[model samples]
Target chain A: MSEVQLTSDLIQWKDGAADWEEAIRVSAAPLLQQGNIAESYIDAMVENIRTLGPYILIAPNVALPHARPEMGVSEAGIALTVFNEDVAFPAGHDNKTQTARIFICLAAVDSDSHLSLLQGISQWIDNSELLNRLLEASSKDEVKDLINQYS
Target chain B: MKILCVCGMGFGSSLMLKMTADKVIKKKGLKATVEATDIGTAGSTPVDLILTNNEFASQLKGGKSEVRAVVNVASEEEVEKAINDFLESQ
Candidate 1:
């Protein structure tokens, strides 16, 4: 299996955003600074949610927001931001919403580049104990440790 | 069997689901080909099964292929069970 590393610089901790769009923008900001993605990628991510709803909510309290590689990706990278308060994303056709505290923004250069990272994330999400630890992680090192241990 | 795993944009959650589904298929010793695509193009793709979240699955109801709504895309157990159940029915 291919391995992907999670660096501390790509992780952020914030009180919370007023809404999911803001949350996604905040999460993708680090990647933008690193030149891994362009501003359009961020807009594409939010646009995806607006049109398709929050299918990005892979699990309760966890969301992986991303758009197509051709949208605006400069390279393959991943960034994560954890909010102290929950943010809501559109849920179903009836206008319901799902709450998420952890947002992992992904920027892949191609369809297959992020598969390994996605697999690692899937394993982490399936482990409730680890998921709770991630939600409670206060420091970047704490979050990095958890990701290293699991991913 | 051919399976298409879908999400809003096809790069994130659906890719994750594809990984999980691939693992399940291998562990179960099932012969299947799985691919990931966005919701916009998922309907046009010809596949035997479509695996996605409940919201998208609902929209795919009455389609040609079987649609399986995975409650937790990251849970290998849930993905495995859904695929196994679908296979058993066939």
Candidate 2:
């Protein structure tokens, strides 16, 4: 299977977001514009969190927001949005707070296509240095370069 | 052993956790099969163990297989430790 590339058009570097829901919407905006996903997909993502809790905060500083393809996915795509400030999600079952500054919204048509994409994303999330660079990146090109370098 | 990695959507977080768990299982030389599925399907599927985050883990309470709650699904270190601890207990 071919791996999906993180194009510059899908990367957004901004000061921050108002809340987790807005963060997901802002991150998913690129995918919406690219026609890979519809607006309902974004709502589904937020609703999934509401129903299932903040399990999307997969790591210390990264959140992978996604919903079922049947929700409203047109094509398989990934969007990255970095925030200068932290966005908090609901407390976990243990009552521990979870926060993230980087939101990566995933729009997958099926389970098969997302494996390679998750592999690439896991590489970045595992690397502290690379993740730091990505969080601090100022431009889309810089973010794309980092993704290419690590992915 | 059959291990199921579960998340709300099945396509996103669970898949990521499965990938990380696969690496940890292989590196640790554990003899277990890992699969990813949605929370809804996970309840019906028969598996030896279930790996998921805290929220989903709670939903699986009183289920057939043992449920493991991973604090950080994205961290290989955390995943490796959780799998290893479970395997050692078995």
Which predicted model would earn the best TM-score? Answer: 1
| A20-108: candidate 1 lDDT, tens digit per residue | 89999999999999999999999998888788877888888888888888889988888888898999876676456779998888888
In CAPRI terms, model 1 is classed as medium
- Candidate 2: tens digits of C-alpha lDDT, residues A1-151: 1376677888888888888899999999999999999989999999988887887877678899999898899998898888888898888666777789888899988878777888777777878888889878887778777777776
The regions of model 2 sitting more than 4 angstroms off are A138-141
Deviation of model 2 at A68, angstroms:
1.1
Tell me model 1's lDDT, rounded to 2 decimals: 0.84
True contacts kept of each: 0.70, 0.68
Give Cα distance to truth, residue A121, candidate 1, Å.
Answer: 2.2
Please give me the DockQ of candidate 1 compared with the native complex: 0.67
How good is model 2 by TM-score? 0.89
Q: DockQ for every model, please.
A: 0.67, 0.64
Candidate 1, position A37, lDDT: 92
lDDT of 2: 0.84
